[model samples]
Target: MTDSYRRQIDKLHDDVRRGRLSRRDFMIRSAAIVGAGALPVLPFGARAEEPASGGFMKLGLHNASQNDSLDPGTWSTSWTGASFNGGVFNNLVEILPDGSVAGDLAESWELDSGAKIWRFKLRPGVVFHNGKSLVAEDVRQSLLHHMKPDSTSGARAIVQQIETINADGPETVVITLTEGNADLAYLLSDYHLSIYPALDGGGIDMESGVGTGAFLLESFEPGIATRLKRNPNYHKNGKPYLDEVEFINIPDATARLNALLTGEVDFIQDLDIRNVSLVERSGDFAIVRTPSLRHFTFDMDTRVAPFDNPDVRLALKYALDRQDVIDKVFLGEGAIGNDNPVASIQKYHRDLPAREFSIAKAKDHLAKAGVDTLQIDLSVAENAFAGAIEAATLYQEHAAQAGININVVREAADGYWENVWRKKPFCAVDYFGRATVDWLFATSYVTGAPWNSGWSNAEFDALHKAARAETDEEKRGADYGKMQEILRDDGNVITVAFVSWRDAVSDRVGFGEVGGLMPLDNMRLCERWWLKS
Candidate 1:
């Protein structure tokens, strides 16, 4: 083997030896290096115990709105993603615990026509919660739900490249893209792309919440609570050990943590960093800190005044102390951001130099924008994310030094996402981060994208399109790097920090490995985790 491959194997071995990596992860990485059939025999630690079955699991999650809906198109927050998408529905592809992509509903897939056409073979014997067998028509209708002209699905930007989707047979689907995209499979793993049963008339029936997932929705109370039962007919064998699952909406961090400590809930997400020591002292729970792509941002609407000028945007970017936000607000649980959405852990990530805080530079940029001093209102609420209000307060203090008066407007937590987020000129926003670079940029950065920050650049758009279609790794990396530079230098987002997915779990829960891609084990804890007691 080459030296590079040998070094990778050594690292995986060390990670597994130190208990930093699971045995399954070690095997997965090793097989990728030495080929599955050529993998050498090695001691893989102790044999894992079979998962204990038949117990109820309750989770206290942060932030839920009465506006939440069963329709996947309208689903945005983790509240709906965990309860509905992760538990009650399945996507065509899934991001495994090891961060590898694998077929979920589709048993296998192949690319053709210069990677522009994809053929997916559906998994056999899969049936929906209502006893309807999964068919190719179901996948087609479910995907087409987001492609309609007036469809307001969050996934619209990513799926717009599809030229056509045709059911080749009862068990096969053929999708043709307007252009070649090698990362199309990864995009399909998006939570908003959950497959639902097709209606006899047309389109998929999204209101009923009937899906071919590991769980069946029993009750849904919008922002209050959601209840689900194990799917007896689930395709995966010896899975979804929990007999029932409940998700309670607890917007307050203290209340969410209290629910876990009081044994009212088995787990809680977005744990308050200030209480890390208290949880450790209690010893009744264990903290699961997974390195994640989740990042916090201050979004400026480029369409609005003050922010309409690029120099003003640059002045705002230079006014904040990102390190201070990471240290004070996040309690040093995150890395400083460089105004780029792509995380260091992702492929084709560019190591851009950190944007230093400089009052002089900020003043210079403001002067270039024909302003001696600037004042702007920043909308924020506790519902944006943990420590959002505190971060905005610190930012308010930092910008004052640069002659930038920031008015931090505290909005209500109940309907923050629906009311303040994109509607406000400037606001605090957080993204869980998509699986791929293209998915991330397309969802929130591309021109005319629904979640875009009202900033558009023809150069950046060109690079994005070229990179998505390029199959050459070197060429793709270069294109992605240019896009990152463009965003870092001229983007409307002031990225604060990329935080870790810190969650607390009760000792009663059992699981092998956790996924870092999203909170609560990629939001699949309901199905992958089992109750030990």
Candidate 2:
């Protein structure tokens, strides 16, 4: 058998072990690959094939700029998200390929008798890229770095519930929470909690790029490209097989697609839905498409005029034709989205009926709001997400039927996040999605979350907190369902579609066996992938 087919089978075998792959699907894939005569009998639990390491892989990605910082708290774009989390960093814990929590910097953990206090045992002998030994104090300090009173990090609202954090010994760190959080361990895997060596002044050095990940930062030029070399002293025995990697920022999707086709880049994060067939016809590159938690939205500043009125928000929601947007913009590669952040795969995501696209209802809601005809600025940019400009244009046309005049304001791609996103009264945006419902709400829906929630809805905040504190999974799920319902009808956000991640990759790269939790193979492609040649 060819080495490439073996790698694919290896991943399939692991999935079968993890209960993620169905037996029927496995049999079909297996039957299609190799015939019964040429060693067709596949044995279970056979992963003896080790990957061939050493080659450089260039990546083309989107949504990066000169404002990119090494600070974990400031990673808003996928360019930075994949670079920081996938490259030069490690969390205390991580979600495994099979969707279970596992230790990264931490070896193990246990809850105190009250379950409100948790203790994590650190892995000794691990050294940062700066050569500082990983210690309990460093973990505690790294976490506390996000909770500083004057901090503006998106993670601030997440770590605020921690009452105290202290090192119990040279190797043990303890966290005391004001209340019990059943999902605390999952929270630690938040990409913002990347562990870093502490400075002598009781703070982390945000300016320096130092971490304990599988790769060391060779060079980082924001909005341009970053280079890395394998860390010889990395803790994982045989990981980060690639000897060198480069992440190049290519904002324009056509240029990015051409780059991959011409072999300038081995992979790119997003593939324009329009080009899926063209790339397939070329056959020079392979396409990797996976269902994801990512979603697109048209957000409003609920604190501002027109949007502040719930009826206006409802009218806009009714004005949206999700199916039409999916067909025109997404090219029918996405599922419909409710007005909530929770994906259908999430635990508490209820099967709420889709909101009908009715121009009459939209006009009725506008009349109810005491507004005869409304003209609003609807800002859009390519950086918002793939197909954002086209989506906004479609929305503009749809709103016209309801007597709403949506002035489509096209913005520059470079500074949209800083200048247009939350700064504008309304804009188009996207979310990579959080691992859990609590984390999702905390990032966008919470009252003061740094990611521009715009609305200060008291009931949603209370329900979110109560759900987080509940220990029973069933009870917590119920509370989270209620929170989603409130946001759907009464929040300032209108989720238009949930998109699938479609990546165009060179056939040289291989992901042998893995559960892709986040985009780009849980944002660890650099660490887990290898060049077949």
Candidate 3:
């Protein structure tokens, strides 16, 4: 009777094919009872428009560090994730533009009675770029690659719940989790969890660049560019309309915009919100704006000095004028954040009063922490977000009234993510966000996660665990709400603003709907876009 119930019915067709239930049984048990027959045919993004077939497409993006490679686990930013996933890799599952979960390598997945064990039926005929056939073992090995404690992939913590993985047959993979998690399907769609072929070493060959995606890797120059050509044998029919694709790194927003205007690139992402009007007025360009869960924050290392105090964290939260940051830094293109990772666009988002910008409240909390003065260093780079440095300066000015001095550290754009972010006691971070609440938490806020930014709360953790296993929609939503409340008042990170996935583009690029589920049209632009004549 709900959206999720409708989704379950959509998979009923797969259920019928897998011999799990007869047509009559499926119809009687859930389909007809949930009005599946009356459900409208809803497709994510543009599915009805006829796609044009040829042309070279190039994109200017803010991601791509010199540390990049063909390895999926080493992919840390938009450049690597987009280039690799959009071109050369495929996950077990994918989050479509409509925010629904669908099979990528896996044809269908079924849950056991306890919902703790899940079995996936691999889609036949899917093959790696190397011409090797995809099998259940490849899926299992790729998953295990992320589960190891030494794994540095962003998805490591998300998949840590897996207790065991078994290849039931050549086409079947069964995963048993330590606990019931209905959210596992969406979790598998994490960008860092790309499936790879198992090699003779009992592991995947990371540098091969062999994948089951629409493009084959051509050449990669770390921190410079990446070139790829279409994989003619792509599984999707009539896909990868473009013959070639390239991703160029332009860290400065101005440089990226200039490249598009100068005909050096076909599309450019992470356009500064201030330049939105300029791009829109340009006769040769079009604005590609997508409302998204993307949010930027200044992370405070809770394990470090001063920030270790809860009162200090609260004081800093009240010192910032979130509206000013949105109006000036974001150019009024984004909404104010509530100091939580779960954006308002997501499910289980809590509706609460905005944290006020008041020096009095800030001073009050500072006094409670027994600190007369707070001097904090904030690491920042424009690459962190559209106007990260400008926002930090504004925050510094406002905090002056509350007896707080913020020393903003400007780092090089090339290695901001690797050098400044989590390594610094206070720094800036931009989250492209996830399709679900649990994925967001696990990636950035879970205890000791690689990007945890040193935030940990026992109460929040307990509630998160409970919410993951809760089958009742209403109760699960309530559990997540309580978790948000804890984060709102006690969390270390200051979530300042949520912005649209705004990009400035030449008229050369054409696509159906540009999705905001992740950066660069949900990392599928390579397969979904074509060049305009």
TM-score of each: 0.92, 0.91, 0.90
- Which structure among the candidates has the greatest TM-score? 1
Cα distance off (Å), candidate 3, residue 415? 1.2
Ten-residue segment with the worst summed lDDT in candidate 3?
A: 40-49
Local accuracy of candidate 2 as per-residue lDDT tens digits, 458-502: 888888888887877798888888888898999888999876567
Give lDDT tens digits, candidate 3, residues 429-484.
88888888877777777687767878899998888888888889999999888888
**Model 1: what TM-score?**
0.92
Q: In candidate 2, where is summed lDDT lowest over 10 consecutive residues?
A: 39-48
Candidate with more favorable, higher lDDT: 2 or 3: 3
Residue pairs with backbone atoms closer than 3 Å in model 1 (clashes): none
**What tens digits encode model 1's per-residue C-alpha lDDT throughout 280-305?**
78767977666667889999999999
| Prediction 3 TM-score vs. true | 0.90
Q: Once superposed on the true structure, which residue ranges of model 3 sit more than 4 Å away at CA? A: 1-49
Candidates sorted by lDDT, descending order? Answer: 1, 3, 2
Clashing pairs in 2: 11-513
Better of 1 and 3 by lDDT: 1
